[model samples]
Target: MHHTRLFDSYICLDPSMWWDNQALLKETKRALETRRFHGTSLYLGIANTADEGMDVTRVLTDTTTATLHMRSALQLQRYFEHNQQNGLKYRGKYYQDDSHMSVPFIAEYEALRFLFGAERK
Candidate 1:
């Protein structure tokens, strides 16, 4: 599972899931720029073939926006693969096995409730 925490929002994504990464990135950028997704921070937990997990966490403040935007752009570009002889195929199949490869969107407000042991808000 890939985890990203942006401000008050947390996203748990499966890398093998399929979606238009470019579109998502584009929308996310727009959201960030417009302050729609402000206070959003994200952590990406990448599991390697060696069975080791790497945590990639970033705080989505104005300072890191440019870097995150660049990474998102690259990820969007790599989401699809072109076989020299074949056509295009999504590169996110690894996370899609068993229909479990998808991102679960969680609001920060809800996370705060759970973190603080408060009643559901």
Candidate 2:
């Protein structure tokens, strides 16, 4: 999204935030802070992979590799929510019943609907 104006919309489902120490998250933060995506749209679909008893607050403090995935994604979700000045049409959906392995189909369907203004029937 930073390098291209070709694609006006983006859909990221259950990103692999464990890669390169979550460089994607860091880069996105910087981009959102510095760049303006006025005509672009971004949708982030977060999966619930938490183990028993681990909520958002609890997993946020955990530095383990297992929890980093969801934590990083959630951070991006919250960031997009709070920082809406960039004129980027952004939506973040948290699927509490979905796991990492089971989010793509639903996320893609919903994302497409959002991008195209399709109503659920």
RMSD values for the candidates in order, in angstroms, are 15.6, 1.7
Candidates in order, TM-scores: namely: 0.27, 0.90
Cα lDDT computed for each candidate against the true fold: 0.31, 0.85
Best by lDDT: 2
Cα lDDT of model 2 by residue, 16-98, tens digit: 76679878788887888777888898889999988978888887898887798898888889878877988899888999888
Q: Once superposed on the true structure, which residue ranges of model 2 sit more than 4 Å away at CA?
A: none
Across 22-107, the per-residue lDDT of candidate 1 in tens digits comes to 46655543433343223332333222211123122331122343334334433433322221122221122222112222223333
Winning model by TM-score: 2
| Model 2, CA-based lDDT | 0.85
